[model samples]
Target: MRFGHTFGRWVLDSLLPPRCMLCGEMVDEPGRLCAACWQGLDFIAEPLCPCCGTPFAMPVPAGMLCAACLAKPPRYRRARAALVYGRGGRDLVLRFKRADRTDMAAGLAALMRQAAGPLLHEADLILPVPLHPRRLWRRRFNQSALLAQALGRQAAKPVLLDGLERLRPTPSLGGLNRGERRRALAGAIRVAPGRRALLVGRAVLLVDDVFTTGATAHACIRALLGAGAASVDVLTLTRVVRPDIV
Candidate 1:
């Protein structure tokens, strides 16, 4: 069996040449970035804001919160992201989300799992931020759902794909400010009917592809809490980390 597996891998590599996921440069393995691309990514690490997981440039006292979190705490208990959403990271996410690169789900989930740390162990269930039916139809797949499923499998936890539902389709929030974004997403999401039981008194790990201003995550967290979820923690593949905040 081992020999057959090795032979199969050799055959596959010969055919596909193990190109890098980001740059398409030939590499040692599939689902990996070239060294240059890897170095270009800013992986979020320690000395981050305890509340929102924003990376701190300079060392601060442990358990310190960022200015934004101090001003307005997010609805979720905590949040973690694997990468800083910059050039390479943003391109990778956009490719996965818009280019039908569902194959990238596993690799992205692996990064999220690493960033999630204790959240995975503490979570009672995994839930993906839902896409409205209209958007889902247009996108063909909810990228968040795909990531949640992959992460749940990695963590050996049950994924509740329909636990939360987007009740209405909102306009693109790309250029909206924080207040506008919040208002736009208000009452746009809810716990799906008949799925609340799974959430009641349970700790949920809310999964998403990217964390921008977190308006979407906050709305989902509110809905999950209202459905009797004990708490919600967020995990995302990437986040926009601002140096000015620290």
Candidate 2:
């Protein structure tokens, strides 16, 4: 069986050689970045706020919170992401999110799994931030759902697909401040009625492709909490380093 599988893979590779996801350079596997692209990624690490995962300019004692979190704490218990949303990270995420590169989910989710060890381990269920039906129809898929599904598989947890619903469409959040974004998203998302009982007392790990501001995560988390979720944590593929951009 192993030999047959190996031979089949060899044939497949010969016919359709793998290429890097970013630069299209020949590579050993699909959904992989070339060395240059890999090195360009600023994968987020320590010296960050324990609450929001925003990196500190320099090392600080453990348990310190960023100013934003300390002043106006977010609704979620915590948030973590794999990459800083710089030029390289933005390109990769746009391809996966807007260029119909669904195949990249697993690879990206592997990174999220590594970065979000504590969040995944503590989550009782995984839920993706939902897209409105109109947007979902236009895009043909929810990028966040794809990431959540991939994460669920990697973490060996149940993924609650469609457990959350976007109640209304909102305008572009770009250039909005946190307060503006929050107001725009108020009452825009909710936990599906049928999932309320299931959510009760369960620790939810909310998944998203990117974290710009806390608006989207906050909306989903507030809904989940209102529906009786014990708590919600956020895991994202990337996030804006300057979350104030939105």
Candidate 3:
């Protein structure tokens, strides 16, 4: 039986060689991504808002904030993304979330490490936005948690998987304006028991796969602050840029 199992594994390996997650060219390792697609990532860098992490062309004349942040500050202290959600980056996120590639989570997490290493070091606890029980049952996995674990592995930080909980199910936020999305997510998150003390006077980094209208991250930030988190930071694989660049 053991010999049969070993032979079966060898056969499976031979039949399906590992491929790059982006272009599907057979790679030396299954989860390995190709150099072209990797380099194709346009990472967000300097001259960013000290609070919201929005990249700006130049530093604000006298302030630490960006124009969008001046108009409306984010709930979290600072947020940074690995890439602007465009063609190739967005395609990878979609594949990871919807197609169950799972492997893509590691790739995204690696990019995030490059984008936000210092932020990870300041964190006392790492929390992934929780999926409501119903969604968890259906999906059988939370993409945020997967990203968090991969990050924890790389950074040697303890990932508090059970520290946050979604209080109830939320309907899909598709087609909703920012305000509508905020209202939908209101009162949706809570800190788990006995874990609240860990956040006191400690910097917390909320992990999520994407940052859209900022509604989801804001909702989680409010809950964490209410639970006594000294401050909150957000890390995401991609940030959605609005169309019609003016």
Write down the lDDT that model 3 would get.
Answer: 0.82
Which of the two, 2 or 3, has more TM-score? 2
TM-score of each: 0.91, 0.91, 0.86
Identify the runs in model 2 with alpha carbons over 4 angstroms from their true place.
1-15, 243-246
Model 1 sits at a Cα RMSD from the real structure of: 4.9
Q: Which pairs of residues clash in candidate 3, taking residues 3 or more apart in a chain or in different chains?
A: none
Q: lDDT rank, highest first?
A: 1, 2, 3
How do the residues 149-246 of candidate 3 rate in per-residue lDDT, one tens digit apiece?
99988888888888898888988998999999999999988888898888888789899988888999988888899999999999999998643111
Model 1 ranges with Cα > 4 A deviation: 1-15, 244-246
lDDT of each: 0.89, 0.89, 0.82
Q: How high is the lDDT of residue 175 in model 2? A: 95
Q: Residue 59 error for model 1, in Å?
A: 0.6
Model 3 misplacement above 4 A: 1-17, 28-30, 58-63, 243-246
The stretch of ten residues in a row with the least summed lDDT in candidate 3 is 237-246
Residue-pair clashes per candidate: 0, 0, 0
